[model samples]
Target: MSVISDNNDFSFKKNERLYHRNEIQELFKKGSSFYLYPFKVIYIADPFEAKVNPQQILISVPKRKFKKAPDRNFIKRQVREAYRQHKILIDPEKLNRNLRIAYIYTSDKKMPSDVLTKKLKKTLERLHQEFTV
Candidate 1:
């Protein structure tokens, strides 16, 4: 199979792709954004300016609601899987363009894995369209 066909072959070059606390806090002061969705997915996509890499795309679940590591971890894993599956849909050429996307779970409860997967795909589709537009 061609390399592109292998999702595992995609190079997520760095572990620091996700913004650190200081970076997110600093983004509020320095960076501006184009609205992608309803909820404010506050992000600093600057680090991606250097290369066509997915420096980090964060998906945060609420802490107050889950109140347990297992629940949070499960939801995080589901989110990561959904991203992994759909990420290749977005081109590497365009990767650096929309680099820092922070997809926060604004909902109240932890949705089922299937439900989250569906929502994630829909959101990614919208992002692809908007990014290309």
Candidate 2:
């Protein structure tokens, strides 16, 4: 067990990432989702099998929205960093099954990193409130 402090000492490990192609497809195909402006979040609670981590997250930047690879990669970094900072808000022990979450970039224009960070926080908070209920 780990205790998350009110500090900036957080890490995003390999286990916490969503990687498998099939899993990503499943998440997109059947997961419940919502949009927060430039971001569209899709999540599935209690995935049938136990995974290596309690939560697995994937961030996607559509090529249509970001024509350049550099732009897409930059946005991906921003999303990952935001999630890493606020992940402490979610406690793994409280949930019985794995939570698979995917963040899809949906806008044509780019927004400031601060705005993305704020929206990511709101997205995570909404996820927490959603499952806790």
Candidate 3:
């Protein structure tokens, strides 16, 4: 697919991350969202920035559910890795717009990497399908 990068490096770079406070607020307040078990995806499509990638994502692990800092960090790390591996499931060109997505882990316990990856794949596919229209 044209959207698949040849690099295959699968590195999650700074540009691919959602960091702005305004953007994050807008995403949760106005974006369309859905939940799939451990993840709740909130996304909004905006005009593409001149040199930015087609998507910027955020991963949130609530401290309320995972009180320990280590637990939260570990879950966030797993989510990031999963997204890094399967991100191309969404065709960038088809979007015609830049997507800002937030994947929030709602579960109170840790999940296996394999299961997390599978769920993330499905989540990405679902995001693609939702925005493709």
Best by TM-score: 3
What is the model-wide C-alpha lDDT for candidate 3?
0.87
CA shift of 86, model 2, Å: 0.4
Stretches of candidate 2 off by over 4 Å are: 1-9, 47-51
Worst 10 residues of 1 by lDDT: 31-40
To one decimal, what is the Cα RMSD in angstroms of model 2 from the true structure? 3.5
lDDT of 3 by residue, 11-127 (tens): 789989999999889998999989998898899888766576778999999988988999999999999999999987775655677888999999888999999999999999898
- Runs in model 1 with CA error above 4 Å? 1-16, 26-40, 43-52, 95-98
Candidate 1 has an lDDT of 0.61
Q: Is candidate 2 or candidate 3 better by TM-score?
A: 3
On the 0 to 100 scale, the lDDT of residue 57 in model 2 is 97
For candidate 3, what is the total of clashing residue pairs? Answer: 0
Best by lDDT: 3
